[model samples]
Target chain A: MSGKVTNGAGGSGDGGDGSEGTPELDAAFFARWMTAAADAVAREADRLTELDSAIGDSDHGGNMRRGFEAVREELGEEVPATPGAVLMTAGRKLVSTVGGASGPLYGTLLRRAGKALGSAERVSREELAGALRTGIDAVAQLGGAVAGDKTMLDALFPAVEALADSGGKDFEAARTAAEQGAEETVPLQARKGRASYLGERSIGHQDPGATSAALLVAALAEADTAVEPEGDADGTGSAQGGSGGSE
Target chain B: MVEAHGGKRVGIVLVSHSKEVADSTARLAAGLAGVPDALVAGAGGLPDGSLGTSEELIVEAARRMDEGAGVALLADLGSAVLTVKTLLAEGDELPEPARLVDAPLIEGAVAAVVTAAGGGDLDTVAAAAEEAYTYRKL
Candidate 1:
């Protein structure tokens, strides 16, 4: 509650900004997030590999699958109540269970985001942004990559900056910025880590991490729509929200 | 005298070098772990005129894990690792959290199977495989 921005116990909706958001992200949302993450990776596993093969060892997709499956399995065991803890747990598990650079990087995103949420049952757009900021920092720490590196950070940093500049009141705007940032990674020259080794070769091809980063942003934006009063406003109920808690 | 323990709740999987051995081994292991909810999958093994690929067996085992310790994948060598890698490749996205434990073929399988059935973690199954590493005089 302290870390996440929320609407309190009242039934106030956060709109799309995630500020004025739910005081508590439900379990259903957590499940949806996991499914979204898995689906995102599954949809682009081959594409991810194609991107990685050009500069790295060419096993990004395989590596992602191992982590995602583990996350899905872990979720079945226990779903953390808060949005942040989920990401933290998922991130840690991926780091410990999966091998290679991507594991630590992706794991950081979830872990830092979870930490930002603290123990709050709900999170505000600001809180989510803060958590992601922490996550982006962790990735920088773990991978030591900066902006325009043709790595995940290239996309992640811009997204974070955009989110922060918006003051956490506009999830849609934040989402759009993240998407655009991810796309911009394609033209940049890799400056660090494995991708940098390829030098000019890394150009043109989209960074797999960046693509996945965009998917995560898109998933968050989608979560808001699914939970909003108009979208699935009916009583049938559905698994809505981000996997931030289950990570 | 193989035994499968606590496997009933988690639903474990069995992978042998041969179908007959796989079935027979399941029977022996069942006694060791008591009656388990473990799932047995061995469609004939390499060098045994069996019908399935070791990769398929591992994939089956992984699927079983997803169905519920996650999964403990035990194989009778030959193409076990290769198949395991192959299955892992197939899971280029959404891979299950199963471990490929190298269990001894003849005598060791019984112990591995029993331990795996006991709701053992991938680590436990792997340890069992290592413990069951003794070569029989046969």
Candidate 2:
């Protein structure tokens, strides 16, 4: 196993069960497969927060590192019984463990997504899309923020839109748009969070939340193809929702 | 200052969002410390570990320091401090000898580190960390 080989464009997709017998996207499989997503997050934790330091807050990587670490710990010794359970518990951990506005917003996204996932092991892209839509709405409700607010929601909204627009057919295409949407937040003034307090000062710097959002999309894309690294940091770095890695 | 870097070892643990970010910070921090300073080790988040939490990162940073006077953990927020504490308690053994300092991350990490490099104890090092939020106070 390559302990530390940096893949700039994301993914070495040979992960998750790509077998024919296990060719099912069932809960057990999804639970098993998401490890790739987990690894991607863990490996990139610090970089994510560093990007945040440039713009909004400098805690994105730190926050996600905490949340995902919890996920890995919870999944320890025993896998989550169902996809929904996995997400719900993860979301709850974020809400309880993480601090800041991101805690609730991201926790809501996961919990909402998990609730929609229910006990089923495997969910099609369509199923996941519905759940993500639920998550997006949940975030909006929880954070009282919307697109163009220069937050993770800005990146998240566009990705979901792209997903729905494509009828949930193209994960890569959707990821690209999500990434683009996240990057678009750079020029936006902060309408929320401490960065919002900074007003015009928040401009020019990349939105940390949006940057993380793009990482999520990149992880999702990695899940689908496990393709070789693309160009240097091709991601838009938006869609950057996080749980603040709080305790 | 105990004046130890020339005679002792130091460890570093930083919490960032990505591996690139972590490495970048580690590289810079390592450079800032100088070769004669202390031994610095780091880890990043990429969803590729036994656990993927920020607290885990802090612990991982702590663990990397095998023979240092103690560790100087730099955090991004108030709660990041809490997570690091939780991680340390779960059998991670952080006595007074082994310290965890939560400083103001972006600029504060460097300042606290610079103070630590001068050979301060955990309390003094941590106090330096507070400077991240109040550099102007100096």
Candidate 3:
């Protein structure tokens, strides 16, 4: 689901200049990204719960829905002054509203990433990528999980890695990487989270957390495409040209 | 009713996914400590009374238990622990110097309540709760 740039105002730099190699996303962009993520979560809540029912406590969908709805309401109440503030506020809301491991894990990711972003009015793609890596690391440390543990990190680590390596301009590539990573979890035996309690039964079920993570990354790509339709001709072109090989 | 032991002791908090469990455990711990007036509170369930932990409830319980000394929190199950961890990481919502004691829920609550009733400080109360992890049930 693409989130149209309804409020492209505020923040220090207006990143739509065609001369710049990469656009500097502002607070509004991050807000729009979160809102888009919330919308996606709401749309796929049932699927998430279904996936969780297979291995988890079957509350992932409801937990994520409640948390993201709170984020949307908080963002609607008052858009923060900077990207970091927006992320931090959203993280706090998630931590308080969502009552599960996902709550703290996702909350920590956003909070740590927001803290890394500091109070910058605008952030470059590279800065955003690095900050996301920092956030993912925080989630890993909080959850005591790694890539092959069949958790959200499975999707998140690959997506951030792809984004960082692409000089932080290839949100589409990151999205695809995240989707592939999520799919790869279907064959993995979980070593972390509640799913690990199921032991061998955890196999053959796609991780709900990784699936939602993919949706989040997909929303990011959608936000990027929506923000500047013509900024990344290659991005938009490849996106429209279908999911072809990006090597 | 147990009298105040000359000073406020470390507050004890019990957290669980079910409100009933937390409430009863709190009652049982206080009763076992022989101090019916010990500073202890129970937090559990979601706002809708569902079977899930709530940070709002946990913070509220912590605030109620905080008596200028500090609070020692014990949680049951997955999200209960995670929710407490989240609050601890935030560090600004709960009372100053709150801690999440790692121990068996009922045993830890009993140990913490007894120590607090005896006017134990934060560290001592926490250590007492942790020591319950190795207590012999036989």
Candidate 4:
């Protein structure tokens, strides 16, 4: 699950001097990332609701779709100048438009990351990684969920860990980690959120929050691949890169 | 038909997943208290009248019921509580004061409304709501 950094095509040019040559992710990347997230959520809305119906309310899918649609609409109205501004606005929209515990939880994640990014027009991979850690931590704090709680944290915590462990150079790795973490939730009883009311009955059902969270990381990977296609001619850089490091 | 509450007393907001639940609960609590002066509003369900809480509705309720004294919020179930907390966290500027009380819905609403009718302050009315938590039917 962790290893040495292998410079992939996406990360090749940086001198490893650690700062001056670091690639700066721009607002365009953030916009594409959010759009990808909305698309993924829309595509999987019914599945998410089905998952929730097993252990919780059957509205997770609809709620997430509505929230992300609101985010897209807000972004369409006026594009923010910086990544932080874009994320902050998106977070605000989610909190206002989404009506469940997930709204505030996901809202805090993006808003905290946006605040950590500050007013910077762009951010280094490392900077983004740190900011994401803060964002996920805010989610944990707000929801009172830890990795084993069968909540979104089950997916989010591992994904963040993968991002940091990879020095933020591999979005694919994080996405895979998130997906795997979400899958792992199928066997665990929920210890938090509305699902906790189900007790042992919650086991065997995949957590809807964790499933959606995985889609978010997968969207991040897709956006990363799209923005930096130099070393990713096959469009499969992160997966290969992640595998290489573990070897 | 009953006369509306006419004084600057603590307000009450009932939050529930069902519109019928919130509205009926508010009516029952208001009736039990018989206080025409206490402002009570219901924030429940989606705009389409589905079974779910809405932050917009809650904020609107808080805005309308607030009178300079304060507002006590009573919520049913998990998502309802989360929605109310999230709304308050977003920094909406409600007139006067507001507090989210952790207590049983129907019983707490009755206690809270009665306490507010007597001109209780924010904390006092909230305490009255909390007191319902200890009420037992043995």
User: How good is the docking of model 2, as DockQ?
Assistant: 0.04
Worst 10 residues of 2 chain A by lDDT: A15-24
Over 4 Å off in model 1, which ranges? A1-31, A228-247, B1-138
**Model 2 Cα lDDT, one tens digit per residue, A100-134:** 44555666677788888776654556667778899
Model 2's TM-score against the true structure: 0.52
Which digits, one per residue and each the tens of the lDDT, describe model 3 over residues A142-217? 7778879999999998899778766687899899989999999999999987899989899999999999999989
Question: Candidate 2, which segments miss by more than 4 Å at Cα?
Answer: A1-24, A32-34, A226-247, B1-138
Give the per-residue lDDT of model 4 (tens digit) for A122-153.
Answer: 67777788889999998887666787899999
**Candidate number with greatest DockQ:** 3
Worst 10 residues of 1 chain A by lDDT: A231-240
Best candidate, lDDT: 3
Model 1 reaches what TM-score against the true structure? Answer: 0.54
- Candidate 2 chain B, poorest ten consecutive residues by summed lDDT: B46-55
Please provide, for model 1 over B1-138, each residue's C-alpha lDDT reduced to its tens digit, 9 standing for 90 to 100: 233244432233456546676656666666655654344444335333533333334454456545444555555532333344333432332135655555665345556556555556556656766677665568
Error of 3 at A196 (Å): 1.4
Candidate 3: C-alpha lDDT = 0.85
Chain A (candidate 2) TM-score to true chain A: 0.75
lDDT of 3 at A8: 32
Candidate 3 off by > 4 Å: A1-23, A228-247, B1-6
Candidate 4 per-residue C-alpha lDDT over B1-138 given as tens digits, one digit per residue, 9 for 90 to 100: 122245567889999989999998989998989965346888888778988777778888888888867788999976788766655665565455678898999999999898887888888888889999999999
Q: Which wins on TM-score, candidate 2 or candidate 3?
A: 3
